[model samples]
Target: MKYSIRNILNSRSKANGNFFMEITKILGHKPKNTSIYKKAFTHRSMNIKDSEGNAINYERLEFLGDAMLSAVIASHLYLEVPSGDEGYLTKMRSKVVSREHLNELGKELNLLSLVESKIPSGQFGENIHGNLFEALVGAIFLDRGYKHCEKFIYKRVIIPYVDIETLEGKVISYKSLLIEWCQKEKKTFDYNVYEDTGNDDVRHFSVKLSIDEKVVSKARATSKKKAEEKASKRAFFAFQNRISQFK
Candidate 1:
């Protein structure tokens, strides 16, 4: 019995040591509170609870990190683009903190490798990467402070990816753009979505995007939103010349 306890303790000690080294490299500074960092990578499936019965996971931290990211990015935009109006600044910030962009950043950092969960890692969706990234930001905030959080964002997000010229031209959401264009042109549009009848093991959804009662594009994906986005992308290219002018 003593041997088993000792072995367990040794294993956890080793894991914590490795985690500290990895987190230090990522943060560019040693974490004062390592426990918070662990919570950041914890998956809800683990069902962990603290002494007061509060659930221990990354969800709450994700929320904090998201707000921090927005604040820092918004502040940078406000100072950098003095001529930008409210709408312009808001849109620019949205583009910078878009889900797709966050996912890309998370993937680049390989944050998924640090997650602790009861479920298989392969079963997790792509958004998990972004969630972990945000949780890390939250952990940094709690461990160090706002300044450290801002510094990390500048290193990971601003200095590397925030370019006004490129961001202005980037289309974060084709669906939003298509809808806006249709609204401006006073054209009616419809998206006929339904379950795909494919024989693949994974169920799928299909979308047919019609503009002005004429089918402009058809696409299929694992979810309704993805299928719609795919259709919207095809439709965007179809009406590229006109849409470019409208944009």
Candidate 2:
């Protein structure tokens, strides 16, 4: 007895019912291509390969989704804020699509619950949720095109969450503001970062923030960027009154 292609497809369809239901609940729409959704949730640790021998995982989709998200957000900001200059629009888009914000959005939706992976979710970092969210966006784009993807973003992101007036005052990075203030005030500022190769399980970086050639603040974190930013934030608070006058 030989099974037809239709029979194989039907079997797969039956197996994917639960996944489709979960996706529908999250997306507020039924997924057109279930395979795309599968790839969205597939972790690199699974090491699965497609018929073409290419790795089946979310990383590539995450990259595509990130670009798509930026484009959609930029377009929306452009149309809504007709008076906003390039810098203003760019900053607004950054606030909307920031990694921290994306992570929060993913967590709110409990996107991790749908992930298919060999590694335990507890072993994953906070960024995993954000990454998975991006992958899902990419899958949506591939399965339904830009218009549908935009609709999804607008419904899931823009409608309930975005408030332009509130976002204008929001500080995406206090460190960036501090650096700009230092530059404007003609005060020499530098971040001295060095690797902390100590006995700790996670490798870290230490940062010393120097203003006018004097050490003002210091911090340490798992990443050099984060350590430097933390040091800058500390320096900013110490000189808040002085810095506020610059702008």
Candidate 3:
């Protein structure tokens, strides 16, 4: 029996083609240039460099993606809510594009599965998903142009996820709300954050939420901002009825 080299090469090429097809199915479009996608998934820890010795990682793409997301989301909100003032539209866009929301979207689509990183996924914080989502958006923009990028956002985000009524009521930052309420009520408020210096590997912060010189709530977290935010959230719920009237 004669084994032909050409036949073996053709079989391998066919397998590669099938792999790309699977990736296209996952991405919802056939990739025009695979290199863009490759760069999107590359992690900074890998220390990859381009032809000019410039760092080649997702960070730059993430920046571009963030701007692109804001633009698309802003346009959508502007057109959909005709009665919405600038402030209202901006808030609505923020609600949709918040880091928490983006992270949830990325996780739902398993975007992290495509990331190329030296660090273990378990070690990464929740923001990794959001960052990767932004990078992917940037990649799509570069590979396919603005119109295709807009189409992708419309299909993946607006069509399935956006509900104007639901978004309007969503709270992106309880801390901001608490502060606003305090200001409106002519009451003084402060977040006193202190180092926890606990036995845990991660540093911790303790926060006391003071309303009118009295401590309303106390909480601790891995970061001072998070601790303060948690305390403020608790303080808000404690005064929910009063806050609702102010809103």
The candidate maximizing lDDT is 1
lDDT of 3 by residue, 100-199 (tens): 9889778766777767679987799999989988888998999888888877777666665566755876677779988899999999998999999687
Per-residue lDDT for 38-125 in model 2, tens only?
8888898978776556788899999989998999889888977999999999999999999997886787678898887899988999
Off by over 4 Å in 2: 1-15, 170-247
Candidates' RMSD to native: 11.2, 12.1, 12.3
Q: Native-vs-model 2 lDDT?
A: 0.80
lDDT of 1 by residue, 1-247 (tens): 1122223224578877888898999988788988888889889997877656678889999999999999999999998899999999999999998888898788767888888789998899989988888999999999888988888898777766676865898778879989999999999999999999688699899999999999999988899999999889768756743212112
Q: Rank the candidates by lDDT, best first.
A: 1, 2, 3
> What is the overall TM-score of model 2 with all chains considered together?
0.64
Among all windows of 10 consecutive residues in model 2, the one with the lowest summed lDDT is 238-247
Residue pairs in candidate 3 whose N, alpha carbon or C atoms collide under 3 angstroms: none
Better of 1 and 2 by TM-score: 1
Q: Which whole-number lDDT from 0 to 100 does residue 141 have in model 3?
A: 91
